[model samples]
Target: MRNVERFIGDKLQERKDNLSIRSLSTNIPPVDFCSNDYLGFARSGELKHMINSTLASMQNHLNGAGGSRLLSGNTRFTEETEAFIADFHQAESGLIFNSGYDANVGLLSSVPQRGDTIITDELIHASIIDGCRLSHATRFKFYHNNINDLESKLKLAKGNIFVVVESVYSMDGNIAPLLALSDLCERYKANLIVDEAHATGIFGANGRGLINQLNLTKQVFARIVTFGKALGVHGAIVLGSQNLRQYLINFARSFIYTTAAPIHNIVAVNCSYQYLSKIDHQLIHQKITLFRKALKENHIKTLSSESAIQGILFSSNEATKQAAANLQSKGFDVRAILSPTVALGKERLRICVHTYNTDEEIISLVNYLKELN
Candidate 1:
């Protein structure tokens, strides 16, 4: 135990020396910019009202799920809700998991077999990387959003091929070339699995995600959508064929071994979806437009992204952290994505534009960024 403590201390000291040490911070700034709540649904009083009202009408609502979904946690309402969400997304079926991370792990870790090849984007999320690590399959990473590189990997792949990518990258704030990738996968006879965590409530007609918006739902083998982000709720759903849902139920250790979410959370997910369909998503796009325009006018460079998620790259972790600190001081909730989270020298400020941000706020934030520049 003493040796283990020394090892941990040494790792921490190394991080501190490099100015990349991470610590939980409760000191959130007043303005909104850093969160995944792009539609402002997470902070919506109306959505809360709907959740509370729905919960009130239900009888015998359990605070806890009591067990995993395969056991005592299995409820008719949960199954029905999953079906409803699946139908909403135009998927043949769906299965719910505790989080986007769990869904990614559960699906990726279990689906690909020993002889299979799992090809992923170089900049795919940590959860997907972890999942691929857990799999017995051969794993390969292609250059981010490079279709030609992906095709090269596909040619080298063996047995069953699984191509994985995010619809919207969380850190880089860029949308994947889904159309091109879908065509490439079809040509290679590879299954394309998309993680739509960042695109779930910001794209599509009713936020059905990028695949649905692009009419590629039928082409995708599977999609993992999360409620914690734009839906401003919790939990996640893996959308696919009915057989896939059953397979995850039997084999996804993350889903089978873990307890289910509480009744309130499930209810919130349902209510949030209900709220999603009625809201004007145009407001979010409008904010994004305003932000981009402001950045351009201020001559502040940012990553090329039309999505709600946006980024400004910095050369070093220290520079990124200091920029975040400066923004926090100005009461904007911007955050730095440092090395290790991203490759060294690719540190950035990951900014999220929301429907709730005012025109003045957008301009002010960009002006500050200009000053920083």
Candidate 2:
């Protein structure tokens, strides 16, 4: 037969040819700059205990859920997690998926019909884009956080429509004009889907997410919130009406075919919610305030973001990488988001403020950046 190895080799070559090849490697010992663990919950002892307690209650089934949720994997934990999540976000129901990526793919791919028009913000996550690609809808992208452009495109659409956006744009570390967009979607009879991947446990009153704090949960159609980033665990939930959730359970291939998320992972997420509800939110908000202060004090121009995500935009990728490298040389950990991940000319070093990040660390990192200039 024709060599099977050659086919695999050819595909690998395409990645190199297109300059899209990605390789994984371990990091050298350094301070933190490039992780999504905003609440520092990822390494928290409390969260560990929560997980331990959960493990104590259940079997240590670290193995695959063994089958899709509809088959044999669905359990009371899944149901309870979804129920709590829906109540937390003030939704009628919630559908659990294995990851934020899975949740997005399942929602966008299965929910939108062939005749539907999807108008998404250009700055939305790749998961949303992939989901839209799988969808049978006609899609359009408006400018990043530009509600006026969204309105224009929304006005032109004449069909079943959905407006997809992120509460906070990941790379740029900026908030969307949610109020304006929600108003436009209402005027145009379009459904709204907000992705809150970066806003959990770090924003909102009880960390229900930005949209939830704004009380816009009822105005939106669906929200995809992940536990990995802020909740310090894995999996995500799609919050919406009972009918919408039922529809996803029935039709979403990602949810239907993939193994359900492990039990401990679900429990960890629940623990995070409990912690957020019980903790001092002011302690976290103070970190955000101090981080913002350090950014301004250092005179490194940052976007006016109220959330934990902050950005230091350098002129070029080399400049961005160099800044991150310089930070690493010291004791700080900050990351540079490069081109294509963000559009050209907007590459940034994304700095996530968290509960564990001290005021001193924030000031020190900013001061270091100033010294570099």
User: Against the true structure, whose TM-score is highest?
Assistant: 1
lDDT per residue (tens digit) for residues 1-373 in model 2: 4788888889889756644345665764355656787777889898789878877888765555667788778888879988998998888999989999999999999988888899998888999999999999999999888888888888777578999999987877778888888888888889999999887776787877889778798799988989888788888999999999899999999999888876777788888888777677778679888877776776768877887788777777777778877888786777677776777677788887777776777778778878867
Model 2 local distance difference test score: 0.82
> Model 1: per-residue lDDT, tens digit, 155-231?
99999999999999999889999999999999999999999999998889888899999999999999999999999
lDDT (CA) per prediction:
0.94, 0.82
Total clashing pairs for each candidate: 0, 4
**Model 1 steric clash pairs:** none
Indicate the TM-score of model 2: 0.92
